[model samples]
Target: MYYKYPNGDEIYNVMAVYEAHEVYGIPRINDDEGLELRYFSLDEPIEELNPFTEYYLRKAGYINKW
Candidate 1:
């Protein structure tokens, strides 16, 4: 996932999001008519994140640091 720098020109990946998908899970809605819906929310409850998670803080490292 990537965030826009207000102007929508700058974009970058946010590892926390990727990790959340692997760890917790993302809500998915499946349709039988050859259509699939995958829902993703960036608003994560603070408690959902690992306390030891230092991605938001580290800034330098957002991958597995969380």
Candidate 2:
């Protein structure tokens, strides 16, 4: 997914998934920066994730049994 900030900056390749805490969260994709990304509740939309993020999530078994 892509997050367009109010300042016109864009964050690409975002991913959102369910967490063990029973909430949805967006993990940090920037390993080098060690950024703590945002988290969204179940009410939020997670279907807007990017292709690369989806592939990695699936491969890592974050989501399965499709």
Best by lDDT: 2
**How well is each residue in 43-62 modelled by candidate 1, as lDDT tens digits?**
43344554444455345444
Model 2, position 23, has a per-residue lDDT of 55
Superposed model 2: Cα runs more than 4 Å off: 1-45
Q: Quick one: RMSD of model 1?
A: 11.7
Question: Which residue pairs of candidate 1 clash?
Answer: none
Q: Give per-residue lDDT, candidate 2, residue 21.
A: 78
Per-residue CA lDDT of model 2 for 1-66, tens digit only, reads 667999999987645555657554556576677555666443433567666765776688664654
Among residues 3 or more apart in sequence or in different chains, the pairs in candidate 2 whose N, CA or C atoms overlap within 3 Å are 1-50
lDDT of each: 0.47, 0.62
User: What is the TM-score of each predicted model, taking all chains together?
Assistant: 0.19, 0.34
**lDDT (Cα, 0-100) at 24 in candidate 2:** 48
lDDT score for candidate 1 against the true structure: 0.47
Q: Which candidate is the best by TM-score?
A: 2
